[model samples]
Target: MMIDLSRDINLLTKFSIFSKFPLDHLEHLLNCCGAYYKSYEKNEIIYFQGDDINFLCIIISGSISIEKIDIFGNNTYMLDFYSGNFFGEQMILDTPSISPYTYKCSTKCKILCLPFHKKYSTNNCKNTCDCRLLFRENLLNQIAENNLLFINKLEVLSKKNIREKIMTFLINESEKCNSNKVQIPFSKSKFADYLGVNRSALMRVLSNMKNDGLIELNNKTFTILK
Candidate 1:
């Protein structure tokens, strides 16, 4: 669907990347960099691994699951991105790049795509130069933070045991949410894939942990009790 520029620009403002941008500046940027809106159904592929990624994709609603498929057809879950989160920011360089992971809709989704190359090709007016600079700075900061998160993901994957892995992941989530009670973003199967564990084993470990009085589990929310 074609975006109603005026109405959607208001929606874009809700994202932190555009938090500092004035509405007029944002509107000008939107004009300079064409905007596209796309919707997908649950379990639909947004982009396959090795697909060209030429634009920044922001989640306007719902969530996306990122995973990699190996030659043997084994799948490894990488991460989940929710509304206001974006992908392809790292690929928005001078050269074209392919996605390393597949992006699939975890639910019905609405996304906005902005062509970064368009922004580069268009000369910025003096009035919007500050807006361009701010946006670049914001993009860089987001990229750095994303890198840190990948490193943290590596840490989680490095644990020696399933119990350790589960605790490590829950602890990280607790820290991120600043609460002892943390919500698990993915379903049990997806979470197991992320942890590189068998779903049955993961469930058994969680049950044991609860019985050990180490944690309290309530649906998707787990509270660190110990």
Candidate 2:
């Protein structure tokens, strides 16, 4: 989608990472960061695992998911990101490690990519740049948050059973929503994929959970009862 500069700045404000960022510095930040926008079609592969890439990416629209493929070609869903959310900070900061996950566009997507190079980022920045300090702070914050997010992903993926996976995910969601009633971000089948469980098995366990009064489920919404 072609978004005019004014509207683009407004939409950027909606992203959690950029919510507190000043609009007056938006355009300059893009310039200093070497930001350029690009679009991808549904199901397109954005960055394959092991590829050499070092650009921070922010979703301007649509969604993307980080997935991994095992040697046997089995796929595991790692995480999902929506509009305004960002990724790749860890990769950029930890440049020695090659990419460890496949980033795929789950829907038609638009994203702004900022290419960061150590040689060009500091020591001799161009004279015209004005948001250098703020931009560096942004990168530090993104890297810090991304590290915490990795830990959260590990906690959820470590569950041993479908029931355990569901419970872990639901409890985490509850903490985020600060309520017993929580809504998952994905549909049933996608949720099964996320938990690394067979779709049928997930549904069966969820059915049992509902009947056992452990939870109430209506579509993606669930309320913990016990």
Candidate 3:
């Protein structure tokens, strides 16, 4: 489906990287880059590892899971996407240019695909000259944000035990939502993978937290009582 440049500009601006660009520049980008709207059913694989690196996709709505599969066929969910986040851009930096993991739609999703220019087309002057610089700058900022996310995940992984890690993750998520009570946005199995622990272990950690008066678990929701 074709999207109107004017309408998409405002939605794109919600992304931090594109927020700095002028609306005209963004509109130029929308014109130059072919936009495709794709829909994925829940649990459907959007792209698999080793898929060709062709386009960068922006999540317009819904969530997706990025999973890393081991040789044993075990899968670990590495990350998730929401609206305003970009995915599949890491392919631009891969040496062999293969996707390192698989992206699956956790819910029904809509995404906008932006294909890279071939041979640096100068057909659209607005995009070729001015908007090109903005694109590069936006990419750089995205890289920085990704690096920060990596560091934060590493810090979480450094916790001494499951309890500490769960606590750290909960506190961080709470802060991000700007509230003490937080609802996990993923399934139990997915959340376990994100926490890098087994499902049972994660449950035990939550139980311990409740016993310690740190949090109250009601169904799937977590209320920080401390």
Question: Which candidate comes out best when scored by lDDT?
Answer: 1
TM-score of 1: 0.91
Which lDDT tens digits does candidate 3 get at residues 95-167? 4546778988989999888765552343555433877777767877887876666566677788988887877
The collision pairs in model 2 are none
lDDT of candidate 3 at residue 197, scale 0 to 100: 88
Among residues 3 or more apart in sequence or in different chains, the pairs in candidate 3 whose N, CA or C atoms overlap within 3 Å are none
Q: Least accurate stretch of 10 residues (summed lDDT) in model 3?
A: 119-128
Question: What is each predicted model's overall lDDT from 0 to 1?
Answer: 0.83, 0.76, 0.77
* Residue-wise C-alpha lDDT for candidate 2, range 1-226, written one tens digit per residue: 3335676777776666664677777666665556778899999988898876667778888999888889999878977888867776654453553667899998999988877556236443553365556655666776677666667768878988788878888888888779999998878888888777789999999999999999999888999987
Poorest stretch of ten by lDDT in candidate 1:
119-128
In candidate 1, stretches whose alpha carbon ends up further than 4 angstroms from where it belongs are: 71-73, 94-96, 123-128
Query: TM-score for all predictions?
Result: 0.91, 0.85, 0.84
| Cα RMSD, each candidate | 2.2, 2.9, 2.7
Candidate 1 shows a clash count of 0
